[model samples]
Target: MEAAPTPTLLLAPMEGLLDFVLRDVLTRVGGVDRCVCEFIRVTGSLLPDKVFYRFIPELRNGSRTLAGVPVRAQLLGSDPSSMADNAARLAELGAEGIDLNFGCPARTVNRHGGGAAMLREPERIAAVVAAVRRAVPAHLPVSAKMRLGYDDPGSAMQCALAMQDGGACEVVVHARTKADGYRPPAYWERIAPLRQALRVPVVANGEIWNLQDAQRCRALSGGDALMLGRGMVADPGLALAIRAADAGGQGEEAPVEVRWQALAPQLARFWHLVCKDLDPPQRAGRLKQWLNLLRRRHPQAQAAFDQVRVMTDQRAITLWLQQLVAAAATADGQAPADPAA
Candidate 1:
């Protein structure tokens, strides 16, 4: 039998979320080929060295992830020169690849002519990619991530073509138009045409919520790679499951109880990391975001999350979380007693 192809699964970089702790957890879960860091915003003339370090701290000692998987530094900006300068700084700091963000749908980002708005002018998109390509080392790859278009699907082909023409190694296309705002029924079929139109590799993104969705996306886009976002949050083991399924390996869906039990420790770790860096109220808010996802997976998670949600005191929250974990263990039949009850 011929050897099976290596699956290409990338972790999407979500701003204000998917921070270092989450990245570390997901990277160790296996099956993710690469992960992109959150976009480092570029607003002015100079690209500071500190900003590069803030986003890609692994550069401090030439580390990638603990698993040795590569992480790319993603940049969001409208200025070609500034983008190029930042890309150069990232290269100097040891980034294996640089990804340009042209798919961000946030109102604030688009209002500034950054993100998907860059697609409005194909010439500018081409210029930015070309400038960044020229500024980075010849061997270091530069890529672009984009949505179908601002309001329609028409500009995707043009924008992708421009990026390819400007020397981008690959372009990842999120199948929804900016107006869609992550609604259901992502138009994966739209990416197939763009794949046909561009010379560079085309990666399909958006609405790939499960292994089935990943399979459908591959069939629809006719592309080899995928970039996952919200899907991973709902189920962190999704990438691994997809790869296993593709390889004809039997994989079990992590039972709801098992998933919650596993996540308790990760949540504890994330809480500690956030408390060390943020104020009480800020830390609580971040914890709440994870709780929201946790609750979706296991309704009983809300009981545990409630113990920490309102407490601004880190010690109080930590204790509450410990009690919650104990309660979850008892509920899972893995321990002796329900401490909360």
Candidate 2:
């Protein structure tokens, strides 16, 4: 039998969690093929270019992560014209690609008629995507991501068709609907119809937290590609593991222990970036957010988070993280099972 093609692995765009700093860290870790910028809110008159830069500063750097992985700028809104206008401006600013977010389920965004809330109006999704597709250069890839639906899980097919009608080259379907709201039972099976129905590539999302989940998702969703969000955040090595599996090996080929060892410096870099952009309190909070997520996958991260969660100052938090890392690194450079491991 002919060998199966390699699956495309994308880093899902996360709002507050996966900012430029985390994007840099994850992309630099390697294996993630592409990333989407945190959803940029387009409200009222065309947002100044600076706004896109603030959310996706990599635009100024050729829309690439530090490791040169491409980063697409994602816009969120209900206005077709404004979204189209903003997409045009981003393209002008050297954005590598454009991703429209129809999958965000945050109450704040939904209240404003953006994100997953737009999924409820399939026609509007088509119109907005069509407008943006017209605005961007034909050569530049345009894509959109949405959950199954607003309240009904059955709306996925309609939403996928809307994206195709609007000229989207690819569509990612998060297995659940807006009503699901990050709940358990991600509905991976629901992506099958979207994959079968859409002429374009259908990328699966939601509930892929590990290698086992990735296998199940592909089988259930009938998709050759995946966009991982919290899965990537909680376990930074997730993309590498998934890539390993896609290549016909168990994802465990890359030892998670060594992955954590290499990841320590990246956390330090994240702290530095947070300190530079945010005040002291925000800095600690940002680090804490990552730590909390990492804790779900690594005990070392849990210990680190416990040590600094109450600390209010950036410098002190930096000192704590650095010392912990220093102690973790050994003569042979293998990660220890505790803080360093």
Candidate 3:
């Protein structure tokens, strides 16, 4: 009897957030196969090795975490020649794979002819991917990440075909237009035609906040895989739950669901890593940012967020988190209420 394969869970690359530190924590949760580093912006000149190392210093460790998960480096730019040149450098630096970022919605990035702005000109996508493809070894995989379109969802199919013509090994559609910008009710079904049109595999992204959402996304996108961002951040155990259900009790790690009450110890570990890399202000901001997302899943996280909303000290926040965990454990006799409610 053959068992179904576990779905590939990818931790998304979110710039200015979810850096290498966060990647380490999430991938350690056991279901994530690999993670993409935040996008490194490439302009006219080739960036130095230090720039790549700064965003993904794990390159020194074979571009992997301590757990041995692979981390692909992602670059954001529109120039064919410069992008190819940088892609060559990344490959030379021992990148297992390279990802092109055409889906970023930052006005600054788009205004400079990068990110989702490139969607307006689908032909140029072919040119850039073709250039990068030619520069790298033909055997090496080059993938793209992008939104459905600039303003309308109508551009998705054409844009996806452009990547195929450009020689991308796979394309990831974020299930929303550049205009959607993290709004609710992602158009997961819109990705179906694009996935059906391409020769390469299509990975769906967006609005997968839980196991139910993940299942719904799979059915709607008809995708080969799923790329998780804020959803994984909110519930680090989501991918594990999905994997456990698929394995049908055959997997090594039993499924674990993370509730806000149970998340304090993990957050403590996450904070420890955050402080090692970021300054005081940055550390405080990072904690708040994660709590803001976790709040959606765990109402208890709201109390934690409120505790540190004004505090600049990570240590203080850690103590408050520990106390909250203790209180929650005591209140419900070990089973906390649903935070979503």
Candidate 4:
């Protein structure tokens, strides 16, 4: 019998989060096929090569993550000419693919006529994609990430078809309009219509909190690929679990102690990498953001996060982490307490 193809699962790139360290850690957990870099805003002249390297350091090695997973560079902009120019530069820098961000709902992005706001103008979306396709290398894949619409689901189908006509290889819909903004119960049903409307591959995104959610999303969109976001932060092994369940393998739940023990090193690694480029205070804030998500999986994550948050002094934060690690070791075999609770 011919083997079924391995489903493609992508890790959605989050700005000011999901840096190289986090990507490295999550990719190790398995089942993630591709990773997209945070959107690099292209406003004016073509970005210098260093800018591309800074946002997508993976491009240094032909856009491959540390684990050999391919990473695509994502761009956010309103100008088709500038976007196409930048896409060409990214391709020259060895980027394997280019992803356009039309899904972000941030007011700043929307006000700039970018992100979800672009959905209101299907012609502009098509023009941007067409221009970029013309400029970039033919073999380099160009994809787009979009929300359902600005304020209504009705607009998405037309926008999606426009993106397809404009030459996008695939479109990833976040399953909600701009107004939804990370709320509960994502309308996966809405994505179904958009999928049927477009000839390009559709990858579903949003509110996929577990294996069941993933299955439901696949059924809804008739899509084989999925893009995971915040859910991935709460449970790093979610993709692995989903893959296991799909393969008829039983899922193993890691004990709280094991979860924390595994996370501590990852936290430290992320901190170390950020500190190398960012100042101490900025690095600390980034650490807190990660801990905020880590706390969801292992409640005990707060003890370390709180220590880092309260202490303004960098040296003190480092000392507190050392003590927390020591304390965690001594509390072996006990049910992990929820520090955030």
Specify the highest-TM-score model's number: 2
Candidate 2: stretches off by over 4 Å: 1-4, 253-258, 334-341
Cα displacement (angstroms), candidate 3, residue 306, comes to 2.0
For candidate 3, what is the lDDT?
0.83
Q: Arrange candidates by lDDT, highest first: which order? A: 2, 3, 4, 1
Total clashing residue pairs per candidate? Answer: 0, 1, 1, 0
- Model 1, span 99-199: residue lDDT tens: 99999999999999999899888899999999999999999999999999999888888999999998899899999988997898899999998888777
Query: Can you write out model 2's per-residue Cα lDDT over 236-274, one digit (the tens) per residue?
Result: 888888777766675693555335666677787788778
Q: Tell me which residue pairs clash in candidate 3.
A: 299-339
Candidate RMSDs in Å, in order, are 3.8, 3.2, 4.8, 4.4
Compose the digit string of candidate 3's lDDT tens values, residues 1-341.
98666567788998877888878777766688888999999998899999989989888989897668899889899999999999999889888788999899999999999999999999999899999999888777899998999998888888889988998998888998999898998999999988777888899999988877887898988854899899888878878877866666544222434555456656766787777777777888898899888887777778778878899866687676666656757754774322221
In angstroms, give how far residue 180 of model 4 lies from its true place.
1.8
In candidate 3, residue 235 scores what lDDT? 75
lDDT of 4 by residue, 102-174 (tens): 9889999899998888999999999999999999989999999999999998989888998899999999989
Q: Rate the local accuracy (lDDT) of all candidates.
A: 0.80, 0.85, 0.83, 0.81
Ten-residue region with minimum lDDT total, candidate 3: 332-341
